[model samples]
Target chain A: MAQQPSSDGTAGLRELGEFGLIDRITASVARTENGTVALGPGDDSAVVLAPDGRVVISTDVYVEGRHFRRDWSSAEDIGHRVAAAALADVSAMGAKPTALVVGLACPADTELSWLDGLTKGLADEAITAEAQIAGGDVSRADVVFISVTALGDLAGLPAVTRSGAAPGGVVAIAGTVGNAAAGLAILSRGFRSGKAYIDAHRRPQPPYAEGPRAAEAGALAMCDVSDGLLQDLGHIAAASGVLIDIDGSAFEIEPRMAEIASALGQDPRAWVYGGGDDHALVAAYPDRSHVPEGWRVIGSVWPVPDGGEPAVTIDGEHPEISGGWGHFAG
Target chain B: MAQQPSSDGTAGLRELGEFGLIDRITASVARTENGTVALGPGDDSAVVLAPDGRVVISTDVYVEGRHFRRDWSSAEDIGHRVAAAALADVSAMGAKPTALVVGLACPADTELSWLDGLTKGLADEAITAEAQIAGGDVSRADVVFISVTALGDLAGLPAVTRSGAAPGGVVAIAGTVGNAAAGLAILSRGFRSGKAYIDAHRRPQPPYAEGPRAAEAGALAMCDVSDGLLQDLGHIAAASGVLIDIDGSAFEIEPRMAEIASALGQDPRAWVYGGGDDHALVAAYPDRSHVPEGWRVIGSVWPVPDGGEPAVTIDGEHPEISGGWGHFAG
Candidate 1:
């Protein structure tokens, strides 16, 4: 299985004891410096500030051999990307992340360094979003997995839900879409030259601030593109009772992605439309004029015909089904 | 592997699909009646009310075998017990749980009924605590595990932490202790006659309300008895800079547990002092007058002399080291 939690793998979790492991995981957190933390780890529960009177919460689970492979990804990368995945859900709701409570289930033989790297990754991502690691839990298990619960504050703004889009709305993207998928494809083929794409997959740098920015700009609907562009937009269409028509010609694959796609005998556009996990923020706006600066217009919304099911199409027709979800390769 | 997802040994999670599984899990929740849900499942994240301007949050992870054995514990019991474990953490901070976001990682072949039973257990426990299931995430793994994140409202009260105990403080407990450990012991011996003990182990009914009541009563410090009376109290002593002395004569072994221990040639007192997981609320109060009606006094707090270590003792003497931690048997 090539499972090496630590070199020599002698010092495992049981040797460290429960409290000892917990202390190491959260010891460096400066709880007092975190503005939202009224109470932090080592207590029964952490008390976090919810100044907006509401908190947006979401959970994401990452399991070894499913979401990641230790042979391909480092512990830090797994932690960072998993946090980004859950935090992006909060962003899709147009909330600013406040705190995260993480839970790790692993074999007692897990390496302390591997756990440390995971903690560092989670903390790094949370700090990037200006959130704090408030608390966490650990347990012994055969497989290694992490579960993160991300909490965010709305700051008194109305959430931009999936049902808010209208017939005349414009759809836009706020971060790199499909890059992570492209990266996963590269890795699966046993090549590692595509550093940019691979890094994107390893640690998603989601445009977190753009969520609150979109809400402020009167965006109609929003969601993070984690299930590929077409599938995710289809959800927006169904929820908003509208039809979405993406302009196929709008996307121009960058040199880095295109070069790799060419060598691999793949169409980059399919990756753009069907690949997921880049954690890009996709939203519907009134028009191009109202779209924020960081976002690029990609599609348009249309009314669903009477008794017609909501759908997402490329240039007025359904795109070909690729039937490829890269994360499932394991 | 004894993997039976359905009676026909088919219809695993991969067959039902992710959305279908999630829909069945959350379909029956009355989100509207919850009173604190600004938004519920079906969205990227759920928004819960935090009118108190603060939220108490905690996480706990439970793994198969380490936490529960399918042959020993029903899916519902596993879910219920896991939820109780996390919720007790919130109550230990003197807060009322508002919502929970759960994460499940299991084999693709997991039984739909098993998953359903687990969902029911979690929802039932959350409902009993006046909390709602806000959201959840699922992933495929070789082993089944669950992680829960509980959020609670402090209701404008200062959080009660472990560092608040003082000398001469009265140590008291609300709800039963040691029963769960006794149940585990009985089960390990292949005896199922102790229904009450077994049920206590399966579904710990922590006095959740008493936490806030204790806070209102001006209790000094508190924690759920998770690692036995002596060990958990040792934490209070270490954190509060005080030493604790249990009144050995103060505890009474209930007939249900005593009878089982007697049959097994085990001292129930060992289970009482060295067992864990009853989730009873243990607290330190200034005096008898300040102790809440539901709580019963069991020990006293004393000052730790300068440069002396904090410790927990029984009647000014170190209790016998039984070296028994029932949970570790798995």
Candidate 2:
């Protein structure tokens, strides 16, 4: 997405070449005290500790136009966003991230400082998640694309799967949904004054530590809100063979989002229900008491009758919104 | 690369959408008897067994125009080649590949059948290496790019790194070099008559099992011939602080390549020495007696003199190769 003219006085990636960029990148990042990554980049492959006997892995791809625009977001923001998208998957599995590897394809003419900024941003998030940026690969392409794979350890606990939700379970969510979508809405209308919303869209701060806390609190099923709350909860319902009902009244739209929605002639509640990339953690617990702090109970689960399909509903009826469910096209 | 008209009656990726493409791709692959992947796609993340307490991981990105061409190579061949590139890195670590994850970014208009072919090809190599295609992600992009991350288990063995080469060590290779480069050469000239070379260009058959064998046989240092033998051996020399000498007379070029080269007015031996993508295993052993079966001794190692830099030589002298050493650019 960095189709902009270079403002960097120094040489860009084309001048540095792949090896030079890799060397500069590796030299910049500091190794953590944590020994998760036994061997980082520069070798044929990275060696990561998987002391819990298993590794939780997930991959996500981000493209130029489909994921982000260089004009709207900085290279660092794009990096953090892409890394969050992948790392959140690991966190949602009730695991502690150990390492993440990146695969980047961009035009050879890309700015060296911009690529460095992206790498630094990725490292920032990895450090926050207590994970190491273990390794990466780079290739030349006409358009930019980044693919990140995160590996996590369960810390000797079984993974919390989506199929474990049961009837009578309380559904809860930690962190905000619709903030990113609302932010995207703000950015789409050619407005930049909404700093909070725009920043939320730039780099979503997923409650990474909350996932394992929810698992330890005896949550049955869990997932991250990448595709909005209702759409993602639908996954749990289908897998757990249970009917999930969300209280539409549970959503409390922020004052700023509401004010902006009114000005934009959009519904703020729809953003709460259908916006994606908030990276919020959602789980179904045995009861309200099992839900951890920072996670609020928003719904309940019920059994599916024979020949009945598992589904999600808002207040005993299907919910409708004026706009479609996804706002992640930013 | 798949910008061509779709001949398949089935709906393409654009019509199917990302989720649908994922479902179809996952459904087509079979699980092996091995219990490497504790959980496959469908949940938030995949669970892969890393019983050895550590995992060796590597990633590689293959773009359509830079790494492959639709008219030159089939989707299946591209898949196999990309898989081999990453898996070989794991093997070079003397680890057994357990699982691999894929990150694909291509135009939504890409054909589903073609993608299936790529998936099948990836599965083919995974199955061969006794590994699984545990998970993958899909995204919309202007061009096609495949990023594969391979995870491997060392089975409690120490990794055989490039820094282990020592003076008096014997250099050996388990597979051919230059065949892939020669194949690409033939294909680039619009000649498909060189079936062996053309097939090598399409799919590289790396000796995956030999990696662990070399480790078990006490290989002092090891790596896969990715950037060609001379260039890759240069890595060992640099890392180990040793001088490597390849016996030019040891290389035996195949008659078929020589015949094609004569017809094409090219040097087949140059391909044998400098061509890449053969995915051959190169190692330095204590002596010729320590070399494993199917691996031939090709050279020797020596110490770098004080104030002298580590280097590679041919027949006790520096050798010049006509053209470049990259056969992997195809």
Candidate 3:
């Protein structure tokens, strides 16, 4: 039998049960501003006043083994990754993140401290993203799983779409591009979680403000780089019905990123081209207008050649590296 | 060797990778509401406009072994459960569900048909709830897990809280209870999934409109019965700091529920008293004036005597049965 619970253990999650867990979690949580939250947690459904009558939302999931192994990453890391990914969806639309809801499932033997760590991680990221954890569900399972949903405030701004980039717009990036990939590689090769790369993998700090800033700067199209730079850019190119060309030499290199490449005995180029999860801001800017801080011109949008395939090309060629992670391909 | 890809067997999830699977899923999916979707899939995040500057959100998780089983439930059933539970959170808050975000993590070997079934089930519930699937993330894992987050609009109704009920308020319910417990018993007893009890287990069609309607009808306190009736009601009692007495005589017994209880050779009273997952509406209203249709009065709220325990009592007695489900009981 597993270890027994003592007075220290008190009433663990199993003691609370699913409904009881929800009751305790929702007990102290409440809405601050956001008039839309007419009804908060602890009901059949929460009610929010959607004044403009329209809402924007996005969701993401993080699995214990696939996304981050418990041995290599702390529970706090898992929490940050979950929250960041979900909030990035809100940022991708040139909107400000407003709230987040989380669903967590773990083995009954899981420590309550782990749950607290995860919640603390989520709360930290919410503060970073200017969002709040509104409500969520918790349950027992064989493995740990986290699901996050993020909502946003458009603030009456017109959404910049991937399909809206024109032929003449300049493609620019506004955040670190290859750090997460390097971090993943570092973690994969049995290295200890380095403070630098581990943070990249655990908490991908996306350029939240850049999304709305780019929108205000007349960005024709925009996206966040969860998939590798080339692959994600290809999506924009295909959707906009155009060609995107990246100048390999124009890429901005992070000095510390090279450390991961050296450790993995792999070229930094692979991480730059095929790595993802950096959550960088990529936008198509018209007339190469004044680039925002932390942004650099990396490529250009081109008209599709007559009857030609819409594709992303780098330095006049398609690089032969893997184009990033997929969920169902194994 | 067991079933290689060359032998007409599909590649596993790890083989296809995360990005490949995401590309495939997003490739053919259609965006129904382009205006509401500020950003579509394939980015770090997708953004949408939330004009009202307010948001309502909730989340829930459905696990394979704990929440459902492949042997007992189709992917569709699992999906329906996830949608219902998440949407019910919105309903409980007296809000209209507007959108949903799903997180799916499953084994690589899972069949495509199963995923399709789950998606169809989710869509079916969304249609019933008048909500749309906005976006989701897909990833690989050892076991199938589903996490859903739902958003809603409150239309400016004051939230009905659990602590709002006062002494002398009438206690009411909008749907049946104990059916899911009966269903779980049948499943655990090795009986195959049945059309009746299985339906109760697979899809808990809570009276979604009752929450908002109760709010409109001036419900002082409200909650969904995800725990046993007495236990869940006890939550309101404790939150409102009042004693609740259930008049067991007023329970509107259902014939089907009785049949299932008889088949299992168990007390239906236990299901009603301590079983959970019904997702029914239970509320306390002042004076019982103009109670909505389909709601049956079952009890009354009373002032706690000085130095007396504030608890739920049935017919003026504490039933021998334990209150309800707990998660971490050793």
**Tens-place lDDT digits, model 1, residues B1-330:** 112223452467765667666666777455313787778887889999999999999998888878888888899998889888888989988898888888888877788778877888888888888888888877677778789898888887788888888998899999887888888888888897988888888888988898888889998899888778787788788899898988988887888677788899999988888777788989999988999899999999999878888988899887885423422123
Order the candidate numbers by TM-score, best to worst: 2, 1, 3
Name the candidate that leads on DockQ.
2
Q: Compared with the true structure, what per-residue lDDT tens digits does model 3 show for residues A183-212?
A: 788877877745687678767888888887
lDDT of 2 by residue, A284-318 (tens): 99998899998999999999878889988889987
Q: How accurate is candidate 3 locally (lDDT)?
A: 0.73
What C-alpha lDDT do the candidate models reach, one value each? 0.83, 0.84, 0.73
Candidate 3 reaches a DockQ of 0.51
Off by over 4 Å in 3: A1-53, A192-195, A252-260, B1-53, B192-195, B252-260
TM-score of each: 0.94, 0.95, 0.89
Clash pairs, candidate 2, are none
The model with the greatest TM-score is 2
Instruction: For residues A87-154, write the lDDT of model 1, one tens digit per residue.
Output: 89999999998888888878777777788778888888888888888888877777787888998999
Clashing residue pair totals per candidate (backbone < 3 A): 1, 0, 40
